[model samples]
Target: MDTPLINALEALKKENRISFHTPGHKKGRAYESMDDGGIQENLYQYDTTEVFGTDQLQDPTGAIKESQQWTARVFQSPEAYYLVNGSSAGVLAMILSQTKPGDEILLPRDVHQSVIHALILGDLTPRFIQPEIDPQFKIPKGITLPQVQEGLEKYPKCKGVLLTHPNYYGRPGEIREIRRMTREFGKILWVDQAHGAHLGLHPQLPLSGIDAGADLTVTSFHKTLPAMTQSAVLFAGGEVVDRERLLEQLNMHQSSSPSYILLASIEQGTRHYAKAGKEKMQVLLEAIESFEQKFRRLGLFQLDTAPGKDRTKIWIHTENSGRTGHEVETYLRENHGIDMEFSMPQGLLALTSIGNREKDLKKLYLAFEELEETLYNKVKMEKFSEKYSKEAKEGFFEKEVERDKKEPLGLPIRTAFYSRKERVSINKSVNRVAGSAVTPYPPGIPLILPGEAITRGHRDQLLEYEKRNIKVIGIKAGKIMVVAEE
Candidate 1:
């Protein structure tokens, strides 16, 4: 297929004086990678501006528009927009475009921070529907039907229902049921499917948000598909979404000087997936299942529930072997030179995407075999013996949201996000209203949000996370940010 966007960039490179445009890099002169020879040259050479022939992102008609059309067809959406800045931009644009200021929206509490940002920026009120927590993994699974129905009932003025399908752990929910309910209530559905870019491309994967009839869906192609980091696509499906407003917001959220390199990545990646995704996914699933069999036969590792999951994600419970997820993460990196996606207190996430080679799976099996031995010995030395933790066998995840009793939800997120704030000791911050979100970086879910009263539970969680070397954003040096007292 003709990669129009990439061809345009290559043609510009042939022009030789493309530097006369804008990007001060001047095509690999000052800013080449450490490699300095291969794709680095082309990468900088094609870094371009909205010159005469190159179509503008805000108003596309040429190569850029053509690339988007190809992407839409492949993703099974009526309309698609390339996002240079990642799914965050799409998320903010979708919310602000669909809902009026002060309009209520039903959402899961486990939503990405970008959703919280949209709530603040768009002045949209949120009625949080807590997602069902997996007791064994402690990670939030899919949102339950009762939770969504209750939120919509409590907030009768809700204009839209926003959700995350195939959550961080690859748990696929009843997206079809949610779609049916939203349609019955005359509410638009917006999905933040950042991690489900490969959905609908393969039969084994879950139904995509577009397939589930979402009005607007945002996907980060970088998450699962063969794409560069920060590349994403915004899918518009149902007629409920206003294309004009979506486009306007897309233009507003993104920068004028969008990266040609990123745009070409989306185009090139989409082209490849459209042709070969099904074959690739089939092979990947086979390799993953083989590895799972190898691990299960040994009976050394505790595997997560697989009844409803994307299958590409590999989550192993380390608690059984008397190891924290952080410890396992460190072991994988330091011992095997393999960096994993994310690790929680009880489980570690290993992602298998189109980037993996069959040999990579082979190596992964070997590495985990070695890891299993180390964990067994550690448990033995600690007097836990050859037996695994019984709780781990069944799973040990947090089942529900344990709200802080003292610090109740105080103000709207928008008001508290903009309020004057001060940083205080983590202990002293208790009972004060939060001025900013304090979220764990990997999951990006707010443990404490702006306008929520900080309680003892919040303080303890942050402090424990601090000890574990986990990143807590919106805090300064060891202190938490809180609304300053007048």
Candidate 2:
């Protein structure tokens, strides 16, 4: 069979690489401990639609309703809805349901691109809140209490606030304080907790959005939990949530025929979390600590101990090692057969979960040692300056071109997105309205949003990212789409 994707996947599977990434089952190893009735082995047979015994996802009444109710209880939400389209659909649904067309919503600048898409879909205006950036990581850390207060105060008419808890490297902000402030303002607080499904399972971990008093929350079961990809759950709590409207939005965004395989995995994952997830998380945490200790003793490859850091996310700094994180990631893959979640210029993030074994940590540690030795022999640590070459470092501007100072009343996202646009060279696009969002995946935060005027800073940063081989979503060739003048 001429199945390149399948063949490649099979070949990758044959190599038996240790996973520190997601769909958190770690290639279905977590399923081995489950007492599932051969469902893991025969998942294909259960892939049927809304027939006799099977229930509809759109308007759940039978088994699906019971399953959702159980999950809601497990997560301590007043209501829970299963989503097979992943957290993106849940995010869109949350936005559309909460705000009317042209209504404004308060959100962080570092929100996932899906939130921007929701703005386009709902014709909603975004009141952007600026999160404090990690000086070392060059990524937005998380929204602070003052930032949320200022955002809400500045955009008093905005329907509510939206935030991503434990921003991608798994560091949580002051969510409880932010939640209290949102409540005092008599506004809704919606949380995009896509990377935090395993939170609240352990006391050491940060509280889940539902637990932190968010009016609405969406979590991906597949990210840090043992579930099939594309499975997520939308949680609704507090008096502010419009349950009926939220359900309608879910129906609109989700597929008519949801995958039974995904639904089954969500259910199984819920059971696993309730039954065995806690103990396994404890073990994973201990393993992570031990792994960090090895590097700590050697005084190499420092682990990120950012305040309120989720120890599960191992952010190993390679800045002093004379190799870029991207370079280290490739070396690990080629030499050690170890997979990482993502990499920035400074470091690689290993998204450890309950699925990861102690042996996997040991393998990663050994790989790190080898990488350090290789780098030490080839290049002097002092000689390798600027993180990524000097030019690249200068190009990777930390600020967002005074985005925080800009008013939220730029051209509406939908208007600019649907407007007639023409492709122009990246250099020529400066000062023109962006026709689409230019985002970098892995983190998936937009650098240039639809309706925003492209700045010289945006152009320069994007060109540098391209030169360094970073994937920019909206660029094709060396041009970008800009709103055409009449």
Best by TM-score: 2
Q: What is the Å distance of residue 470 in model 2 from its true position?
A: 2.8
lDDT for each residue of candidate 1 in 267-359, tens digit (9 for 90 to 100): 766865777677777887888888887778544556665686887877877765655676677766656666677777677887777556566
Clashing pairs in 1: 135-397, 136-395, 136-396, 136-397, 138-397
User: In model 2, which regions exceed 4 Å deviation?
Assistant: 35-37, 298-300, 379-410
How much does candidate 2 score in TM-score? Answer: 0.94
The residue-by-residue lDDT of candidate 2 on 1-486, one tens digit each, is 699999999999899998988889889888767654356677789888999889899999999999999999988889989999999999999989988998988888778988999999998888887776666655567788998898888889988989898888787877899899988998889899999988978888888899998988899999989998899998898787888899999999999999998999899889989999888898988888789888675444777877677879888877566456777787788778999998766678898888888999999989888667756576434544445555344543343323333334346789999999999999999888988888877778888888888877787767767876888899999888888899
On lDDT, the candidate that comes out on top is 2
Runs of candidate 1 with Cα error greater than 4 angstroms are 1-41, 298-300, 379-408
Please give each candidate's TM-score: 0.87, 0.94
What range of 10 consecutive residues in model 1 has the weakest lDDT sum? 17-26
Candidate 1, residue 433: how far the Cα is off, in Å: 0.9
